[model samples]
Target: MNQQYTIAGLDLPDINPEDKLNRILSSALEKTNGYLINKSTSLAHYWDANYFNLDKVQIFQDSTPAEQSSILQLCNLGILEEAYFIEKAGMGYMAKMILLAETISERMLYGLFAADEVTHFSQISSFLPTPKVSYNPFLDLLENVVESEDKTVLLFVLQVVLEGWGLTHYRSIASCCQNPHLKSILQGFLQDESRHHATGVTLLENRSLGKSSQNIVEILAMFLQMVQLGPQSVVKAVEQVKGHLSKQDKINIFAQLDTETHSGSRLKLLRNLIDLPNAKNILENLEMKGSFQPLKPSQCVSFNCS
Candidate 1:
């Protein structure tokens, strides 16, 4: 039997061979995970290494095939690691929301959401080379908001805005993913995410930001800043495989990324997400500040994320 690392968790534990109670609990846990896997739409949710389309990525344009392959793998690993942590972060926020649920119905919705997040975490973790739980800017921001003791603000920002954005984010990944099985999971997960997002829309539809407007704008601005950090992933992936790049190299790579198109599409989708009726004034203010504009690769290339 595999040794148990955690004394308490939803994971099936190593049972005492002779302990009937332990065996029963282990059996139940095994079945639970089995159900969750099926609920995720398939049991063969493995990572697919199908060739990544780099035609638009530009960095791979002049690279040798082997170099391109290396960068692709690194990029995939980074994306999966980030997804793993982000989904884990989803579980964290869902659990917190369950505790913060003001009504039985709200509690039920969050309970279901928590289960969905755990399933996503399990599936994404299978794609990782090794387990990692590192800091993520979005995750950190999410954790802070959960601790902020305002349910309405939480709903508007997390569910209404972020999860609303996730519909497009997850759908885009699913559409382009080569792995049929993982694509199915992403598709299924999006359905749940859609419902989770709807919960916020239904709950806060007409609720004014009121006293929370300033805090809401500040939190949202941080998210916009993250949006402005474009092509960083591609640049870093290239550097990892090709070593230190000159500024010109970075700028050239950024140009190849078709950053204008990426930035425009992303900013447009983001604007639509937060354009709620109750947030009319906030939306106008954000638009005025160009908070919804995507970053220009040349300008962003010089901005050091480190």
Candidate 2:
């Protein structure tokens, strides 16, 4: 009999040797967290009409000039820091794909959100003042993951691990902005991400993950190693800003995010997906590993508009 990994705070039944597909599908479902956002009919139109038009957006239309300037600074960073935006948007779809490997839930909605990312990229790209500067690095991460053998591991790497780092990035950028409009925009973009991560957690924990899916644990380990050293933006941030912030500062910032951000909500979904004790051990280990190195303006941008 194959050894089974305990998950969801329960001992998994012994692997059914005769049915391998059932075991794999069950493990995949166990990892999934159910939908949090309701799919309203106008949701798609709401996103497109609101965020796509730079002309229509007046940064904090209700705020003073001081607030507007701060928002512009953030927009500048978002424009300059386009890499993170690109990656986060792409990671939204990638996470869905990984979650897909784990469950049969929300199959149609998963495809919709994936399509949403692509449409979003197009929308965001159209509004860029200089849209010609290609972000090749973002594409490369997608290519590598899509080419990998196991969709399950790739999802955790990109969605949970990589997006976990990105949640911090979004909060920082949003906080720096004093303008309500820009902050609202950032928040709007992030809501989709929040849902995507939730899907990953749901997929990870569905009751189907039984004894035969021990490969998932090792796959998760491999994902952590890659996230710690992948070609993705978080790793890029680390490589660029490895020495800029003090160690304590980085730890404090990550911890602050743990407490303050909606990210903690996603962690709860993860806790629900995995067995309670195992989830605690794994998450605590990840937290102790500390956050990624910060990204500096000098490293992330190549063009200057003076």
Candidate 3:
């Protein structure tokens, strides 16, 4: 494994996890007025009240109380997913290879990123109503990818695609949520994710793939297809959580999710990825293979674009 990729200059601000944790704790204390409850460990103290807007989440609002409870349970599955990835990064075969293939500076940066992810997982877990679970389809996909022999593929899939997806989702959550403390925490996570995505993009662009570019494109296509199918899986998971919702409620939930997936901040983030030079090159290569059709700028419209 050649760990010799050119390092791109990244002008990221210094991040102090302790300061972030302190701010989160102070904010939680202020919100609770010093009366900490069982779940008031951090800014997550406000998660139940402001994390998901019940009224705006029309499906959750219209569903029966039991159905709503189950849906909320499905949503918090992210906490477990994050924690699983952190653990996998430490013990998974691909993660070990990736670390070994990195320069010392890159390794140090990855260490910081891992720490940030752990903080994110712990903060979210603090407020979750359900116990930590071992299964998440997306995380499973990630684990499989990490086992691949091509470390570049693993880097692109996890950092560029998955972390970019997270950055986009977190930005949307921060924008819409009412709690300042929660927003602050999300913003910090967003900064780290942005750095990770940029590093992946730079590395992918700098590498001389030659014949291997085609294989990478195929892998990216498959990963994109998986991402496209994610919402459907989420809907199924939410429905399976309790399984007593009326058919109409399920239909409504699916409809709302479809609309959000197509026109919301998530779509905006995916579209932005297409504009990346490396992503565009891959798309072009795929187009040449008759496997994909390149989208015109007009066809790539996002909610934030205009």
Candidate 4:
């Protein structure tokens, strides 16, 4: 026996009579593929390490440009692949929110979002020639939250924090992207995503996290933990070119990665996003406990943040 799995399966014409209605209902509900990605026949787009600002980082400065580019190409693919799957996961979670929604307007918003997620999944998946799904911790986190959390927490995490954070992230990537097509796709996403983030903010404003407060904090902490991990991707990228690394190499790379500066910026973004009236007390509580600090290289090295 063999099995295949993907949201792309959503696009297939099912043969089963039992699934006939399932196919019909979902087909009308989703905009999967959107036929937009195939609108281009451009050649491949290579990675530009400048996206990570690697030139300013001391570690890559010593290596030749070719070596730096080699590592960045691998890292870039990893970033794109992660985005593809995360967007694919959104196709489910966004739709799931419809049933859990408190208002008809909210349900309608998620209905539209289901289509948006499909479009996003379609666009990003096109960039990969062999589009294999990969392990992503954040995707796992997203799935778990969607499966268990209520509408209020869902709005805050998925829309307010993730989408809000994503606006800046996608902009940075699109701004540095060498491929015009991919850049435009990302930019187009920003318009829709900005609205999505704003909707989350509007829905969540002054709305009590209530019993979900602890859950929301835990989720935020897990997210901030990712921030704490710093730029280990840069280290992994270096390993791609140089192969095998000693403890010292990793430490030196952390310095060059400027973990403090990079991590601080992300934490600031989260803090900005978390500034909700209802969540103000929670934010303060997290601050009191020093939750916003970046992970020192020592802590990551000891625990192997990888």
Candidate 5:
């Protein structure tokens, strides 16, 4: 059964921004740091905790001087790129919602906003000094897989792979969160991301590789490879934070961070949800069962648009 999924499948509602709690959060973040963009595109949706109170989120504001410094730097990076990415992806997600999403429910909408922002926060907070990789190696890989046959391939790369990884990270952080409110907020977002990931996988997987305009097998493989590599920088950052700690402090801090990161359902979501039976089937179809290859942004295509 070869078929193409259209935006028509998406039942996105025109959510009034004033009604959303996340939008209120967006307003808060903006007050804290005004650089965060607030626009949503036809292809993207923006949801942040400023609007919704799915769970009362306790702010992780207190920290050791070092931890505070580290976190501030992380927030700085967000001010530079993460905020923009959040806005950009939000626009894209909204566009997708309008195009492909079915009737939006309160749960589903809450999920969308929290999931997207949390994932966005996770990536930027930990991976500072974002690399200037010309082509976004993953996107390059996607372009090569379809070989220019479709623009939708870009959407798949961002939505399915990049955002999928973001969901996993959010779950991890949420589970590890010290503040109960923050944890609850993250959990709510994870639920939304689960649906988003499922939608992406189902849309791509049900269609056979040959029938689709792009190579489904290759796309799936590249996504998995990209996912494995996504954390190297954040891990490096974490190690840097640990390096400054005394041996005993290191042990305590590491334990604390580990608890925050590897706790409960977060670990399960990271391992099981991402490595789903369907995702595994797609990977096998792509013949990427072997270890994933490390990526080089330099080898990717260069942008020379005048």
Candidate 6:
């Protein structure tokens, strides 16, 4: 069956941001969603409702003074980049839906997914303390994938691979975060990402790879490498913010960072992706060509490099 499944009658929740945003935010974070109730509230109040109160987060409760400072810097960098990537991906998905979706239902689903991404971006951006700017490696990689002319490959990359990685990463962060507000937001994102990943898997399973399997595999390799390398700009930004820290304090902060751990997780996700029933043939072809190799960490140029 070329069309593996249809989500036409899927009983997915109709997310009305106005009515449901507060409920979703409050429930996930275990906090009251009362920030938006008063029309006269300042932007900071709205942001504060979703932002983490460092004193309240469990991870930093027992840390030393230097460690607490480092964590705050890291959180700032993480939050800004998270917002940036969500916005970038949301825009890309909207564009792809308009250009490539073959059915009305598919288009509708993508539209809703895009809307959710924007909502996430907006809420996260609101929480920033200052205007922060940094380069995002993963977002750059996603742009490359979106530019490809092959819609199937695009779907596989964004929905299946990237979103799958996102689901895992978000869950990991949310579980460790002591702040209920951020945890709630991450949960909301996970819900949408799960749906997107499932749909991508089904769509890819039903489609024939034909001659494009090799291309798809190569794209997957590039994505894995990007993950392993981590984001240079974000690292640099964090370093700049923590420039005053002593040498040992710097070491402590880096130790707490999860760059290597995330790389390993992403690599595992890639392996599982190609091990799926429908992906067996593609995997065999790559293995025969001796192209299946583990990526090592290195400082690489932007993802747009050939």
Name the top lDDT candidate. Answer: 4
lDDT of 4 by residue, 110-226 (tens): 898888887787677667644454445676676667666477888888889999999898888888788887888888888888988999999887677888877888888888887
Minimal lDDT window, size 10, model 5: 297-306
The 0-to-1 C-alpha lDDT of every candidate, in the order given, reads: 0.70, 0.41, 0.51, 0.73, 0.41, 0.55
Candidate number of the best TM-score: 4
Could you tally the backbone clashes for each prediction? 0, 23, 0, 0, 33, 1
Compared to the true structure, candidate 1 yields what TM-score? Answer: 0.82
Report the lDDT tens digits of candidate 5 across residue range 1-306.
111222211112322446656566566555433223233221111222221221122222234556534643443333234333443335444444444444466236535554455444433323233323233444344324322334345335445655576676666556554446445655766665666666666655543333332354456554554443322233233335535434444333323333233233333333343354445554445434532433232211122111
Query: What residue pairs clash in candidate 6, if any at all?
Result: 29-180
Q: How many Å off is the CA of 301 in candidate 2? A: 18
| Per-model TM values vs. the true structure | 0.82, 0.42, 0.61, 0.83, 0.42, 0.63
- Residue 57 in model 5: shift from native, Å? 31
Clashes of 5: 33
RMSD of each: 6.0, 15.8, 10.4, 5.0, 12.9, 10.0
Candidate 2 lDDT over residue span 1-306, tens digit each: 121321110122322436656555445434432111112221111121122122233323444655444443333434433533453346355444636454455666576566545433433432233322334443334444544455555455455545554555566656554456446556555777677666655555543434323444544443333333211232123323333544444333333222223333434433344333324545444445432222223322222111
Write the number of the candidate with greater lDDT, choosing between 3 and 4.
4
Give a tens-digit lDDT track for model 1, residues 63-100.
89888777777767766666665676677678878888
Pairs of colliding residues, candidate 3: none
